[model samples]
Target: MRLYRMRLYRIALWVTVPMALPLLAAPAGLTAVRAARDTAPEGAPSVWRPGVTAQPVDAGRPFPALGAASMALRRMVPRPAIVSRAQWRADETKRDSHAHYAGGVRAVFIHHTDTPNGYDCADVPRTLRNLYTGQTRDRSWGDLGYNFLVDKCGTVYEGRAGGADRAVVGSHTLGFNQGTTGIAAIGTFGPGTPVPAAMEHAIAALAAWKLGLSGVDPTGKVRLTSTNGKSRYARGTSAEFDAISGHRDGFATNCPGEALIARLPAIRGLAAEIQGRYARAVPFPRLAATPGNTHRG
Candidate 1:
């Protein structure tokens, strides 16, 4: 009887010890984890800071399908534009194309292909195709990367649009494609060569018209300051009105060239002017006040 009682006591002790050990260890482990999380550095992502919400590429209604007036304006405005051939082929193959229309237009982003200047914009289709097929060994990407390509002749070509105002994904910049329209010039621009006046004018006009349709003020000023809180661009300017921005603003690349970026102030001014004109044509809607009623007879 004594032996049996001792054996039973030992078994109970073993079971209880195992259970109590976990209870003792769990709080310490959990406390350490909580402390580590609390001590994490700033900018480091945590459960509390889940990072920025991804912008929607397609949500709102697109601009009313290009109308006759819009079409006429596009044609009348003789900014030399050409759509690349590879884009046309991609459209045919039904690859990397958007089936749905884009939301309201917001901003315009400009880029340069960094290709040789002598390359003809007229042959842009062939050039893009070659680049996509790996024929151009030096370049990356399988197809034309831009939504619109402006040639040296000041002509504008359509790119990657299956339908009007569609949200076609582009490889222009990281974290900027949402709610932004990208326009690329065919050749590289740098210190020696500035973007032609005609090309600039065309881009301005296109941006202005799109902004007008979207009911956004293109002339609004914007100030892009440094991470250290120092003003990079001038202050009191509408970044939105300054609708024109370089690719380097969001990413690390010398795209759109320094000369082109230098002209941003003037370009933004033009956009603002256009916005003023459109505002005059279409006045914004005002809220109506409700009338108070007295006792009725």
Candidate 2:
């Protein structure tokens, strides 16, 4: 599904069979595929409040259903809120023409954008654009490396060009990217910085829904093959990883930071609870619409 930016995906599939295996190879010729429509973008933030506390779970990170159009993750849990690439105005023209797929996701890699966390919730769209330029033009990664991004306000933005539901391979981790999804928190979360509870829950819900598509338990371990020697493992080496892992686990960089890393257990717990692997999560109530709230399951 190598679609050009601004092109309408003409071909669409209602996937029923579980697609867990060796990922499908992209076809030589360009063929468009229509995916499930993404949720509408939410209204821009009305104001910028520095160091503002995020909304609580019952109010902030509400679980939005993906509707019936979503590809079956083979689970019944509600999909987390997701803002599409269009919502963030991704410059698909800058997208790396070479997109890859991993069939189905086996795990998720967490990262922090290493940027300022004091940004206004309203400015997240602009923030995403800046990240796009840095990664594609400056870093030569071709596109935003993250498959999805989360703000302190708990909003989720679609990162790469392909549909969020699809297993579009991202250039996030060095050797451990294949068969996994990359989710970046949109702020610097070094030590002593308090992680927003909303952000953590949003990450958990997203991870739980995505992993549930493959019938994976967020609290469990997964075997992933490293594709780069520079990574902790040599190429083709099979390694064990927590279902939700920090970027430092695969690469030598202190990307997600120690504080964020320490919260992995709680995030994993929340995700597992969302998936009904443990106690069921709190029932999601319909919170009034806020400025930066929006979903794909």
Candidate 3:
């Protein structure tokens, strides 16, 4: 969606450090999860819907040190805690017959939830749960559209039911979901409202890991075909986009907002660094495919 730029402003605070997982210091009164779960259909893929527990796990954990030999040969992949679908109370009552899997990763799309930005970091799980409810129950979509979500505090949560490491097709970006992954920031970002440093880092780390899986460069560009005329490109049109791009790049919407969109360059650079883009690349990982282009999702 197209978002008009506004001249509003908000003071931005940044905590730029090597974020670790396992334990984190958090603000008080942020210890509640507000969502419910219902039984999923039989034979459906398993979901880890344990409900939101406490604070979210950090998605910017450093990658394990590659051995001296491996370091020079292989790219480092960040290990973000893609909080499983089960972690949040995913009510799969409306889950579709199956999820779609892309052949491989070619690009990454960024987006914003346009939701309230004043929420505490701890409430992210509940917010995501509510979002899933709306998408599946209200909108009648098969599942959450985005592949992953990043909270204001920089935590990454798994969005769709497919494996986070896989190029799982999603409903996000409409005609451009195939061969791409959608990452939505869980807050509205207007012009001049500085995007949080932690959130940016998380997005970078995620892009690095996902794109690097196929040796794709975040600083590079790729050609994607548009399947819907409603999008910025007419159906069957091939458009070139930065490896890391905003939702607005493909569709005619003010998605991902100007503030967050502006930070995409830095995010792309950081993601490249995380993926060791400057160094020699390694072979792409091999994964078995589940036939069928139509992602029943």
Candidate 4:
């Protein structure tokens, strides 16, 4: 990761935060997933459809007290494993090698592929390749627009050519791509649609690590300037946005859909908690003087 000189201190503090689950494994169902063949299958015949009502995760739980030293400690969480372009078997020859790296990441924007949600988790690699063709061939983009893409089952796929460790600029969000990460959820999430709990968990985890790198608060605000008039903000206009924002925030589109957008508040708090910003360093309710509950000190 080529970090800008300005974030040195923040990056230093980012690694020292205390984690409740230091060695936590990848999200449920991710460990068992393996990439499909490099080429798209003739037809997907095995889609494991899920229930309509989404089960909630820890993000919905109440947060602990704000530790006085939390800022100094920084928000450090384990980096989620990202299946690289090669791992997903992207057609390398089709993409142009133009890369744009940013100084640091200030925010992360959420998006949806606008495709059907009843996809087999096993077909993710093929889906990624198809998405690559849509953008590179149909949309004429040099490469995939999203910096990262998460599936319904919580598998994280690395999009774009640049390494996930670096601040690679993407063509997502029209005007807010610079200094921000575009994380597209790999299915359409419209009204009445259920967003899987595992998907939310994975997104929150990834956002925590990415924004934590630059010490950006997931629940806070960031100012960004627009470069394209196609966006809601005119070119050169500066706008303030949440550190974790929806795709519609900067553009005139119904993307990321209503269902996923509704979960943004919980996602922000969860990311904050993961970074230790909203987690407790001291035990709650204070230990009693009783022998069973007393502290050694």
Please report, in order, the local distance difference test score of every candidate based on alpha carbons: 0.48, 0.71, 0.70, 0.72
TM, every model: 0.53, 0.70, 0.68, 0.69
Q: How should the candidates be ordered by lDDT, best one leading?
A: 4, 2, 3, 1
TM-score of model 4 relative to the true fold?
0.69
Q: Write the per-residue lDDT of candidate 3 for residues 1-297, one digit (tens) a residue.
A: 123223222112124444466654333424332221111211122333332222111112233254432122325596776677777767766667566665457789999999999987776778888898887777665788889998766778899876788767677776677678899999999898878777888888899988877777888778777756677887667889998999999887889999988888778877777786754222222212212111111
For candidate 4, which ten residues in a row score worst on lDDT?
288-297
On TM-score, the leading prediction is: 2
- Per-residue accuracy of model 1 over 71-160 as CA lDDT, tens digit each: 112212222233334344533342322222233356667888787878644565654554444411233222244557665655565654
Clashing pairs in 3: 1-253, 1-254, 2-253, 2-254, 3-254, 48-86, 48-87, 49-86, 50-86
Q: What is the lDDT of residue 248 in candidate 3?
A: 91
Q: Candidate 1: which stretches are off by over 4 Å?
A: 1-91, 97-102, 131-143, 221-242, 275-297
For candidate 4, write residues 152-174 as lDDT tens digits: 87878899877787776677877
**Number of the candidate with higher lDDT, 1 or 3:** 3
Q: Which candidate, 1 or 2, would have the higher lDDT against the true structure?
A: 2
Task: Tell me model 3's lDDT, rounded to 2 decimals.
Answer: 0.70
